[model samples]
Target: MSVLVVGASAAGLTTAEALRRKGFRDPITVLGAEYHRPYDRPPLSKQFLLGDWDETRTRLRPDTMLTALDAEFVLGDPAVALDGHTVHTTSGRSLTADHVVIATGLTPRRLPGPDLEGVHVLRTLDDAAALRRSLTPEVQVVVVGDGVLGAEIAATVCKLGLSVTLAGPQAALMEAQLGAVVGGLLGELHTAAGVELRLGVAVDGLTGVGGRVSGVRLANGDLLPADVVVVALGAAPATGWLEGSGLTVENGVVCDEYCRAADGVYAAGDVARWRAEDRLVRLENRTNATEQALCVAANILGERQPYRPIPYFWTDQFSTRLQVHGRPSADLTIAEGNIGERFVAHYRDAGRIVGVLGWNAPKQTRAHRQHLVRT
Candidate 1:
């Protein structure tokens, strides 16, 4: 029962470890494109970007620890092909296994702009390092997008003594993920941090001089002068290499409730789009990465386990900690509080509670999640 895992990220590593722990003593191989060891990505925009943490501190398992798991390591080579039970790598290497797990994760979505020197997108370690080097008090940063990644980069750059202006196409920042009520609250936080918030605007194009970005023009004829432009528009699944692999690929690789794909193949993490109750869902967070990987490992060992749970996600911007419980929809109603110091918002679907968003109120949110099952 040999297993081959594509990607050495959180999902891949967790699946490998879970398989080993389940007593499947078959040969296992982990392939990664990154030469560096498997490292944590959550801190790349927060601590690592601000110089509060080092690259060595973000690793989930160092090289020595990964070797102890008794899995074959193939670093610096990306899996370029998936044919039945075999994987072909970019380094001219081929691997055959009884089972394969695709946990390729995601890549940043690039925007149309002039080829400039001081532009960046924070997804990997190299992106963070390059962006950090350009972070100084003298740099004026124009951050494109207001999602979690964009907000974090904006907050970090502001904390680093750089002027920042956050631009987003939506009326409210992070409105798609965090409903308008919470999005409005976050807007206030960014304002408090001295981050210029520009919403409901679209970038016309980028203007540069001497191969360096100078400023961005808006459709409204307004221009934002920036020394550094960081595009944090969000991410798409890194499944381009799997083209024509006979897998159902939408926004991600579609899988079943057990995380199984076609012909002994499985997928987890940001790359796996599995069936939920009403729809096929793909979560690009660590919680889903770990949980889905565990379920995949168990099913591979003939345990016949099914992955089912409420979706969860969290974000931190300065002192504000926003936590979301359960899957939410765009039409969900929001309940607000006075003063807005601490608020608890409920997301209802068909007159039943489906999600809850909390700010400085964990006890209420915890109780709410517990009651969801009972109600």
Candidate 2:
């Protein structure tokens, strides 16, 4: 049997690696839209953007290990359409296999604005490279989102001694995800680090002068001046290529509990919306990319196990490293430490612990991870 994986990023690469580890000697092919070798994206905004890590440091695996897998790597050609087990690429090439896996990941969302210079988005290696070149202490930078990516960019830019203003509709950074309690603390951290917080205000539009970004226009009719603007407005699953492929697409490619879209087709990573208990859940994070890929690989080998996992996510901003375990969406309460220093916060829903989080305290927070009642 042969397998065709439609993405060559972390998720796709991990799936192929897992297959090889499980003793699947079948011929495997990994296809990618980008020409770059499989690279880790989590560093793109931190170490890479800060120029602390080189291109070789960001690669997920070196040439030696990838060669050991013995999988065909077809780069730069994007898959455009799918007909059953057959995938057609833009270069007029078609590949069919006994099984197909979709791990295409996400595309950064952009606001309706002019194609002005100095405005950026950080998703791909190219995006990170362009934004890195445009960043300096000379420019007034405005990050137009309070989400994870936007917050990271703001932190990284501010660390470089550049003027950064984080503008978003949320009252605090990551409010929608971690709740107000933790969000408030995060806001304090950014403020302490000299990042101008323009929260609870929606961005009206972008102002450009002579085809370059001049400032960001707020919904309240105020303009924050800037020479560079980075739009960190979340992302959507990259499933546009799966259109007309007779697959269910709602937020992401809908799949069964086993992550199988059809008899011989499966999906992993951000592109997959699979059934988890009573709800359809789609996770978009680095940990899920590796974990879910292993699950999919097991099922592809006929293990037939479901992909139910306790969600995990983390982010670093300035001097703080926040770690989250399970779904931290309910009422947040401090389990240890305080807001002024390292602490552990737990989320409770109906008087039962659902999630746990740590701020600058990795070991303590990891100890409290057991409080999260797994579903």
Candidate 3:
């Protein structure tokens, strides 16, 4: 049997490694759009952009460990189309495999404006490198979108001594995910760290000079001067290649509880929308990518196990490390600790703990996460 894994990022690499570790002696091939080896992405916005870590240090596995897997690595070539049993690549190569695992991940959503030199998006290693090259203490950066990615970029740029303005339509930072109470605390955190927060503002367009982005125009007719603009408006799944592949593609490639898209075809990571609690949900975090890939691999190996995990994610900004477990809800009754110091919030739904969030309270939050797993 032959297995073809599209995408060579964390999800794809983890799936391939899991398959081999599970004693699958089949011929396996990993296809990557990037020429570089699989690397961790979380550091790109933090350590890598800050120049504290080099490219070699970002690799998910060293060359020695990758060589042990004995899987063919086809880098710099992306699969453009998929037929029943054949995968077509942009490099004019056609690979036939018995099983195909789609882990194509996501593509950054571009702003509606001209493609200028200084406008950037942080998604890949190349994106980070380009953004880093343009950063300096003199440059003023206006990040559009107060989401997790935008918040991280703003924090990183502020730390680099560059003036950063974080603007978004949300009432507070990460309000949709963390609720207003915790999100308000984050808003205060960023403001205290010298990041100019422009909440509840919508960007109308970008003004440019000499064909490069110069500033951002707001809907209320205010212009925020900027030498660079980073659009962290979230991302959409990279599912264009699977257009006519006879698979269910909704918000993402819809899959069953087993991560199966079709017969002999499975999907994992950001590109997969799996059935969870009677609703289809797609997670883009690194933790979900790794966990779901392992589950997909096991299912591919003939173990009929359902993929049901307690959703977890974390973010590091400035001096705070926020960790969360389970689906946080604004409707749940919230019990919060001191907002001045290290804070912890316990969210309960109908007398049962549904979610827990912590700001610089990792140990206590982790202990509370067990409640989610047990119940």
The Cα local distance difference test for each model comes to 0.85, 0.93, 0.90
Estimate candidate 1's alpha-carbon lDDT, on a 0 to 1 scale.
Answer: 0.85
lDDT of 3 by residue, 1-375 (tens): 889999999999999999999999989999998999999999999999989999999999999999999999999999999999789999999998999999999999988867887999999999999999999769999999988999999999999989999988899999998888878889988999899998898888899999999999888888999999999999999999888989999989999999999999999998999987688989888998999999999999899878888888899898789888887878544344577578677777676778888888887788777778521
For residues 264-344, write the lDDT of model 1, one tens digit per residue. Answer: 999999999988766888888888899899999999998888788667777778777777888665655545554367767
lDDT at position 58, candidate 3: 95
**TM-score order of candidates, best first?**
2, 3, 1
**Model 3 bad stretches (over 4 Å):** 332-337, 373-375
Using alpha carbons, what is the TM-score of model 1? 0.95
Question: What TM-score, computed on C-alpha atoms, does each candidate reach?
Answer: 0.95, 0.99, 0.97
Best by lDDT: 2
Candidate 3: pairs in clash: none
